[model samples]
Target: MKKRKLVMGTFGGLLLLFGAVTGFQTLTLESRQPAAKPTSVEIDKDKALQHLSEAITYQTISYEDRTKFDFSEFDRFIEFLQNSYPSIHEELALERINNYALLYKWEGTDSSLNPIGLTSHYDVVPVLKGTEENWEQEPFSGTVTEDAIWGRGTLDDKIGVIGIMEAVEYLIQEGYQPKRDMYFMFGFDEEIGGEEGAKAIAETLKNRGIRFDFVMDEGGAIVENMVPGVSQPVGVVGVSEKGSATVELTIEGSGGHSSQPKDQTNIGRIAKAISKLEETQFHAELRGPGEDLFEFVAPEMNLGMKYVFANKAIFKPVIEHILLQEPASAALIRTTIAPTIFQAGEQSNVLPEKATAIINLRLMPGDSLEEVKSFIEKTIDDKQISVSISGSEATKVSSVDGWEFSTIQQAARNVYGNAVIAPYLMVAGSDAKHYDDVSNNTYRFLPVQITAEDLNRMHGTNEHVSIDNYLNSIKFYAELIKEANK
Candidate 1:
């Protein structure tokens, strides 16, 4: 009886100690967000709204097939910029790469300081044929309503191009010059992978031996209902972007009549392999930018969440399990698998001799193409199935310890005062990946307040942005330019 009581007492005391350590960590966690340097700037709302609206009409669409690109539309868009922003065209030295990608340099007085690049793409994704009818306004109409600006490029992400231009033009008008140089690059083919546009620009810049202090691209945005335990909106800055890998799983076997089908067919084998992969996904752990995300937000979380995140060392499994429950959150911790296409037998009655499936994967920072391909082979564990993977590895993780990231975080907080700005991993690929070689730090973020729905509408039908959001985006850019220079 005494031994049983002693064991029970010991267990209870251990629990108390565990709780104490967690409580202390939670209490001591500091907010990683930098002090806000909010700047009040006035924008001519009507003119800015008109510019974004008109900009969307250009139909500068990026298609996977390079030959299909309408260079005429791209030329028209370039002319539009020259006509609209005279101050920018006059002050900044603009050059065209491959006749579409626009690179502008605003020479700084001090040559010792390296330049910072602000980048985004003007090429919008082509609206799917059948989905055009679903739009409230024409997909390329550039309709400006009293409350919102309706069009395709309003969101993903001609907004970034126009916003930066407007900010620079405004600054030029206000007699603002910088000691540090600035570069503005707008890619023409970002949606289809920036091989010809951003990649070419980076190569050109690299050949020139021009290295950058920092480069900013369009990515994470101010979002609501994204981070749990934080009631207010959270602004996420992407310090590392996930690599997109395309995996092809193929199987070949003998064909047979439907009535005399073999016990195991190619289609059946491929399906089973996919099933195995789904059952065994990549291991999920809290590390890299994903871990950094929680560290920044834990201090602001409610007591219950704060306790769990603060004591993550003890509750890592629990935290990972909970995060894996939601797709959005699960994506943060590990690499993701998505089967995009399946090509099997065409005839209904004939058993096909071959089966092929293409899987799309977003790789976390540490996950490499070779590692991912090996993982797929091992998980599937079928000798007949062959796996081939091809794609870029994850980009280099940028610095969060200094003003490189804090400049962006502070700029965001200054505009969206209530948002919790934290560093995170961008699951979607962006042009920032191409600039990695030329820039010391590449940060991806679009300065706009967006919702879950707004994200969906990026490459979907009915894509539009509220006038207020558009205006705020301009303000955010203006603040970032001034804040970064300071």
Candidate 2:
């Protein structure tokens, strides 16, 4: 009885010690932001909004089946670009790849300097069959109201395409010239996996052995209330993108009558296997760009958050437990498992022979496809169940300390003085992924401040951007160009 009491006391003391350590760490992390510098940029909001509104009118939509796409729209969009930005068209050399992907090269005064590339896709996803009426304005109308510009591509990257042009046009008008060559690339079919668009462009550049100092593509944007501790708009520059893979688990057995069933049938065995796999997920480790996110934000956070994050080494378990509670934070740290499709028996009366399940996995950086396959096989450990996996592994993690990243962050800060710019891992694939082959450093960032709801509207109904946000995005691009030149 005495020994049991002693053990209980020790356990309670240990728990109290852990809690205190976590609290102190959080405080330390939060207290470290000694100062902040506010930078400013002059912006022409009217021209920026006008360009974005007009860019949305072009129905450069991408379909999974390339045959279904209207190439004329893409051609018309290019013509529109040429007509709108006369100075740019006259100055930069334009090249077309696969007849649709647009690449513009702006020669700098210095040929010795390595070039930087900025890329975005003009194509937007199709409006769902039922959600068309739910839109406040027509998806393709490009309606610029008093407050917001409403359209399909306005946010899911027509803003990026137009924003860059607007910035370059303004810069050129003010006699600003790039010291290093700048390339602007627009993919026609990024929505449909960029096979004909970004992929072709990347290959063309690769064949020529053209490597960039760094390439910036559409990725994380400034979002309000995204990170728990910080109040400022958090602009996340994607340092890495998670790899996507599909795993199929299948089992086959002889058909039998339902009246007399065996202890476990093919259906039962497959179901159990899937359950086990879900139960025992891929190992979660806190590392990579995701970890880098907190490292930057924690310094500017409140005392409680700062302390917890600062002492993460000593309070890792508690910090991880807190991170796991929020799905957004959880995704940042670990691989995500989603079972997209499950197929089994066709008939009701008799037990069928086959069962199958398809699971989609988003791999963390440093994880191997072979290792993922091995993990799934080992976890599902039924000899009868067969597994097959296929997909791309995660991209290389870009260096946050490099001038490539600092240029982006500094430029963003210059445009949006209060925004907290930080590096993060991207979950979705982008044209930036294709650039990984040509550029040693690939950074993805879309300079706009948005709320969580705006993210939903990216491929959903009522997709729009505030006029202010649109202009800021242009300023950000302009500043980025200038910063890169420096």
TM-score of each: 0.97, 0.93
Say which candidate scores most in lDDT: 1
Off by more than 4 A, model 1: 1-9
- Give the per-residue Cα lDDT of candidate 2 at 178: 95
lDDT of 1: 0.91
Task: Give the clashing residue pairs of candidate 1, or none.
Answer: none
Stretches of candidate 2 exceeding 4 Å from the true structure: 1-44
Task: At residue 397, give the lDDT of candidate 1.
Answer: 94
Candidate whose TM-score is highest:
1
Q: Candidate 2 local accuracy as lDDT?
A: 0.86
Give the per-residue Cα lDDT of candidate 1 at 87: 94
Candidate 2 residue-wise lDDT at 279: 88
